[model samples]
Target: MDWPFSRRGLFQGAAVATGLAMASRGTAAPFDRLRQKNHPGWVIGHLTGAQAVAETLLAEGTGCVFGIPGAQENELWDELKARNVHYQLVTHEYSAACMADGYARATGTTGVLCVVPGPGVTNALTGLGEALLDSIPVVAIVGDVGNGEKARPFQVHSLNQVDLLKPVCKAVYSVCDVKQIPNAIRQAFQAATCGEPGPTAVVIPYNLLIEMADFRCPPLAEAGVPFDDAAFAQAVALLGDKRLRVGVYAGLGCMDFSGSLTAVAELLQAPVATSVSGKGAISDCHPLGVGWGYGPHASEVAEIAFAREKLHPHKSGIDVLLAVGVKFSEVSTGYYGNPRPKHVIHVDVNANNLGKAMPADVCVHADVGLFLGKLLTCGDTLRRPTDGHLLAKIRQAKADHEAKLKAIPAAKCGVDPLALVAALRRGLPEDAMLFTDVTASEHLAAESFRVTQPRTYFNPVDNQSMGWSIPAALGAQQAACGRTVAAMIGDGCFLMSAMELSTAAREGLPVKVFVLDDHAYHYMQMLQKAAYKRTTATELGRIDYRAFAQAVGVAYQEILVQDHLDAGIRSAVCHTGPVLVRVLTDYGDRKIRWIEAVRDRYAKELTPAQKARFASRIGYRTLSLKPEKSD
Candidate 1:
């Protein structure tokens, strides 16, 4: 018997033979016969399992993949390089996943990542968990040991990769045969993106990746799920009560349907408040947008009262809350201190999420985009409440918040956090993508900075991880391509993933990294100071970030005063490649005092039972009634 011929040759030869037979009858051209023989669903050529996966990704219109090259996955990397697939080489596997998460959030598409098994898979779990919690669509391709060798004790870097990833991933697939690669990847993409999107893991055994096989790409799956029409009608009737003071609360899940949500809000003349993760879903500058001022730290009931007082002083608390794509997460609900509305119309893609945190009077199980589109069909019949007073209240509330920020005295230690935020807000482009790490800077940015576009602001939100911002910003910039991207990170956060700057430089990603150098874990310090009256082990001796940036082959700048802040930010934003701008910030106790003051104000608004519940939910000791002197 002749040795097995390559699949490419076999297919071409068969096509030519068939064409000759058909051409004798003058039925069709040889080219047409060849084309028909190699229809999209047919196997066109032979390729390694790795190449098949790469081709599948390209077919799905994946523009870039963030990952590290490793022994087990080197074949995949090689295939990606050969096919001109854009692979961003991250310094760590965790950052690779984070970059994918950021890319997915920025582009509203499935982000792809490839890494090796064992430690590589373990290292990426945190990022996967973040993606899972945030509902980001990402497909992670992990390379594992040879199919039969997975259970072998001596196999290097071999472990139960699927088991380790199952909890964090939406679904996990292990490819045992070479031919399973394409379908597995297609399914992984589908699983990652359909409904409440999340990360999915596809593990390809090392042997299968390098094995040659005839490959055919699978047809894309239909991803949309139908909505509950009965629930939609009920929601419409419930929300039609003109006596109800309605407020639309949106979250990250509403991002795809942001336009629809805005249109609905406009039709109802309702003010819209977003959870921190949902900051950009509606432009903060929109007339109805209330911004991210309703989190655990940000008082919700008080903010709503404030908004009502400013806009409709005669009206009572929000009678109807239209929560769209929101989980009513503890943080967003002020540790459940904020009372649930009398009537709630909750809409989400995932049925399980409806009424989990707060009871829903009418639950609509549908894609937010679809639900909002359907809701808009009845927009003409719905009454639009007078919003002139509401608009005035919104503007006044913003002005009052800014006034309070401006009233904080200048810091004696370093640059004031508020002042630094002002500089950043002024210097950075309005459309620039900004990421904030968990620190005093995050609070400052939350209260001070205004994000005018959707998906322009990225925060750890519920994850609250320290090192997420830099790598995430890098990935967002890669997804955005030419758009300016920046991450304002605390000193502690910078140390956690600063090595990624090297990856940024190597990839030629022009990401501006701003280190908010307060010389300590300021957020924790504030907590300690307020709860214990002193801080311990929160101090971080200043690192010469300029020298560190130089070592990593990135341009660096240090801003010590307000005057240099704007120019420094401008320089970094305008730099051709990665640049670090370290702003030495003050460790003022004012932030701590502000936290205490806000809590006190919110406490006064809560009932005894609500206060106890809040305390229990936060799992912290009762704060001392004695007020500390303001610095």
Candidate 2:
């Protein structure tokens, strides 16, 4: 069957067509020899299905696989070891998938994994779901029961694996025949790396993994769909409007073309803001980068900076928004509380996403890299005034925002979350990659941490899943090789995947783990207090992280006060091996109140009806007030 954007035709032509083109040269003899019917390269090689899968992945330039070995898929592990491919062993199947997802996000490559069926596949669903939601490329190879054992009543780890993964994966392929191994592997990678990239699954029966086969590898094709040129021209026209003050909102899709993205912003003299998932697409320190903010729930500093820079259309100045690679999802758009530009030009690889959340005056269905490249080429002719005054205003606003964030009062009880984030930012290298879980620290990091490179900061933004940062950091560190990697996680999030600490020790991966020990699910606890005046099951009793670290064979440190934060963070950063630094932080009520204050200040601009609706939506009814009232 033919597939969309299939590269089969290119593969078929590469060997022969290139040979004929080279025939006029003296080097054609080697090509002629290769064309012989008895050529050795064309011969059917005897390889087990597992070996074939490994070979295919190697050919695709895969450097490692994050997975767990299971009874049914032990042969695959053996073959991977024999082939000298690195297998990052994880304790849980879910962690394996998350590791792969994190690896893919950091490296911009397809992350591969292996797991057994039944609970193995089920356990991987959350990680795959996170990948799906975040548009990350990953291929999960699952092991199923043998072909002849279909529907056996008591077969261990036996279930329909394809059905289980189909909902979360981009595509699911169940290989029943050994000969289909090569093609199936190719298809899985293609699906995972193609447009709207996401996780794909390939379920091969355990018996086939051990069976020998004469595998004929097919040529793989690069996948991308052509975009509409008319829409591109229309977008250019809209952006060229001198009357509109343009602002660029970037998302994950624009990561590949960050240079061109920044170039376009520079040409239009527009400030660039990013979605949380899109942080580091451009250096946050760049002159045109106004810092990360697209939604109302953005970092307090980002929100304040955005408002001061006049990037928010409703607040004051910007008339047009160039949204690239953004989904305009609830998190990114703050449930649509963020105002839409009077004129919007939306660009996305997925056509369906163009107007799915917010209407666009012009929609371009194209790869962000290509689209931005084209836009840059035409940008000179459409250059704007450069707005020196506006640029200065933005710079000043950024300084003011930083000053305000630093001035936030520390909690009376424990280390301030903001102070902890600041210390971490100072301690780590500029290029160090950071992974964050859904916690109060995440919000603080969003406002304080400055990501200077693409793929340097990763968060479970859309999924908001706990226990993601630790394993994800492991995968990212593996992909980064010698580069430093760190995870800022809450105590609650740390415990969810705490077992993976052993995996880091075993692999000898030096990932600095900073646990914000707040003794509760701080984010939800704040919400509970705001909405219901009480907290529940969210609190997690204090953990002895030093004891836990010793048991897991990792380095450990703890900081209870502000004075030792910098030194503690620096020591962890300089550690050559995995280290867990637990910071006993306060309840973060101060930060929560600061955010509420910002929200209240901003809500004054909205009409009373709009204010009421927004308050209800965000569960800020208690904090809501009459339009005329002062704090």
**Model 2: lDDT of residue 504:** 92
Cα lDDT tens digits, model 1, 570-603, are: 8888888899988888866555323554556566
Q: Evaluate model 2: give its lDDT.
A: 0.80
Q: Give a tens-digit lDDT track for model 2, residues 455-554.
A: 9889897777789999999999888888999999998888889999999999898999988887788777765555444566886877788899999999
Model 2: what TM-score? 0.86
- Report the Cα RMSD per candidate: 7.4, 11.0
Q: At residue 482, what lDDT does model 2 achieve?
A: 87
Candidate 1, superposed: residue stretches over 4 Å from native: 1-44, 149-152, 293-296, 299-316, 404-408, 592-631
TM-scores of all candidate predictions against the true structure: 0.87, 0.86
Model 1 pairs in collision? none
